[model samples]
Target: MSVEETMNYVLKIPWHDIERNLISRVQLKKIIKLRIILDKREINYPIYFYVGEKRDHVMIPYVFCSCKNFTIRVMSKKKKPSCKHLIMLRLALDKSMYREIYIDDLTLLKKIINEIIRIGLSPTLRKLLYISRNRRYERGRTDGA
Candidate 1:
């Protein structure tokens, strides 16, 4: 199903029902315990930070998450459209389940950048570089010939 459809479905139904079917026990636990901080200073686009047991993840609601689960499973393998954090955020928004913490936009951006630096380049970035190098090589060969 499309992202929109999935989000709409989740929003329409209660979290309890959706939790039983879609979320695993471990994910459910995280959802309950996770601290969601919202930086809504930017009126057009709000930033969400999900503080998990081990690490903090930067998310853009339903759009993206800095978690490995999202990068590997959702983006790389296509096993799922979203990670537990994203689903939790969606549910939280609908049911008012999250704790609203105020963070300034600049600090939030710095935190997100730091998180990315700590995690290093993702698989998508490596793939993009590889493709770019191959294109340069192909162009060079044609010009040399």
Candidate 2:
């Protein structure tokens, strides 16, 4: 299969079910299996699989997560998106968003940040951009940030 096709297949594999049923039941075994699959495909870096809102979601390093992991990481880095963690998070979040999860508009800003990170932009530039944009919404922001 083409790379794109393979990726689609992998992403569609009912991660939520696996997380809920399989993960806790056989944590080590499932992780080993997942590691083998990722390794065979040469997918480096950590890929977090978890259940969110009863749906399975994968949090790659640079991807955004509704679970707040990405936001926490970015905020900890002072809005910087330089780390590999951020990059993977972006990739994972983009994929998830494309799957039609009804994400709130409040998370749109973080999505933009994820895109910027994916494009190889410098972290300093990203931080500056985030600050500028954040100011625009500061007055009436209800995003619970």
Candidate No. with top TM-score: 1
Evaluate all candidate structures by whole-model CA lDDT and list the values in order: 0.56, 0.36
RMSD of 2: 16.9
List model 2 lDDT by residue over 1-145, tens digit each: 3334334434454554334443332332211101312323543334443322223333443333333443454445335333333333333454442121111242443453354445423243334334645766785576555
Clashes of each: 0, 14
Cα lDDT tens digits, model 1, 1-145, are 3567445544555566566533443343332211224564334346655555356666666767788887888777777766777777776665555543323344545655475448642333233334655878899999999
Tell me how far the alpha carbon of residue 33 in candidate 2 is from the true structure, in angstroms, after superposition. 8.0
lDDT for position 73 in model 2: 45
Which ranges in model 1 have alpha carbons more than 4 Å from their true place? 1-17, 20-44, 104-108, 116-145
- Alpha-carbon deviation at 143 in model 2, angstroms: 53
**Residue-level lDDT for 116 in candidate 1:** 47
